[model samples]
Target: MTKWKAVIFGFILAVMVKSFFAQYEFVGLLIVGFITGYLAHDGAIGGMWNAAVAGALGTIVCAILFIIIATLGGSLFGIFGGLTGFTLSGITSITVIIGYLIYYAIVMGITGAFGGALASKK
Candidate 1:
């Protein structure tokens, strides 16, 4: 499979896994990294880089989706408004989301690289 396809597939898999087993979110991410690394493995291309790219992309997609869902849910349920009655502002929410995106990219990227390297051995 192509890199983009692998990224998409990994993202979907991660989301499904997280939804079903919220406590094992890291395991889902690790699985996604492994799958992407396996799929992108080529004798010429480095598996680590491929897997890292896939992980980063997948995590970014997840972050975006999460932000969208949170925004909708907050609007519909007024969830954000009840938070100490301080009300979460748009800037604060955006900042938090961006921080999470970076955190996910770095953490998941390393995991993916490791998985890709392992897959490359065989």
Candidate 2:
């Protein structure tokens, strides 16, 4: 297939996957993006390792962003008296972090697979 087709198809796949998971889980969109990217490209064992590293980085970034946004949202609600209070603690905190990690990992893995394939001439 042409490079343009691969990119377009990858993007569509990413968006669809993102849409499907976003409602059910957080960080779905980014995960989908990573997966789309990885799948669209090419790689090897070393590439997988690179993907894992990238995935971890992506997860951390998403998790941090989520936490910040969530915290800000909660604070805003509290200020508006829409909510009494919101906080991440213990299991809730852990779960959120882990969820982000998993989502990113899946995304990275998928993207890496695609990337690896694309990178190869044959």
Candidate 3:
């Protein structure tokens, strides 16, 4: 498979695993890196690179989605309570997301390289 296609497949599988392991934040993300690497089918370096990209993208997407969902839920709560939607503005700051993105990218990159080595051997 092409590199992008492998990354897409890896990302999809990572989401599924993440959904199941949602309660364990670090574990979920680490598993995502492994899944991305295994499915990458691009040998060591490629798998590592693809998994890192997928992991970074996943972190960003999940953060945004979480914020959106929280906002919607807040809106619903506000409607029932006759209050305006409470903002989670502080948590949604770009700086926070960037910090998380960097952390995840680093963790996933190293973990993914390990996974990629395993994949290439198999």
Candidate 4:
């Protein structure tokens, strides 16, 4: 229950923060991870895993949203409208997005783990 709550809270906060201050996204993600970890505290090990998953989930959700928005905009406007604004398509674009997802997952997961470790109840 606590873990789920933390995950939902973290996800919501992640979206809300990104919607407003899109520039400082990493910082907001870290803060959300920390708060989620702190809220879902169990033991160091459990907390770390839960928090890391929550953080990664947030990143995945954000990436999905980005893809959706970019696809819609690119289709309507005849351009790739994502962060990179690349015109690349097919395998190359897939590779880029996959790489981005992996990178973001690791980065966000690490921050969450650190937070969980520090805030562990046991």
lDDT of each: 0.59, 0.49, 0.66, 0.64
In model 2, state the lDDT of residue 72: 59
Worst window of 10 by summed lDDT in candidate 4: 82-91
User: lDDT tens string, model 4, 3-106?
Assistant: 78877787678667667877997787777767766766654455555556665566667767766776666644544454345434544666755665565445
Task: Give the runs in model 4 whose Cα sits over 4 Å from its true position.
Answer: 75-90
Clash-forming residue pairs, model 1: none
Best candidate according to TM-score:
3
* lDDT at position 26, candidate 1: 74
- In candidate 3, where is summed lDDT lowest over 10 consecutive residues? 79-88
lDDT of 3 by residue, 29-92 (tens): 6776776777675666776788777767766776767666555666445443322332436445
- Which pairs clash inside model 3? none
lDDT pick, better of 1 and 3:
3
Estimate the lDDT of model 1: 0.59
Order candidates by lDDT, high to low. Answer: 3, 4, 1, 2
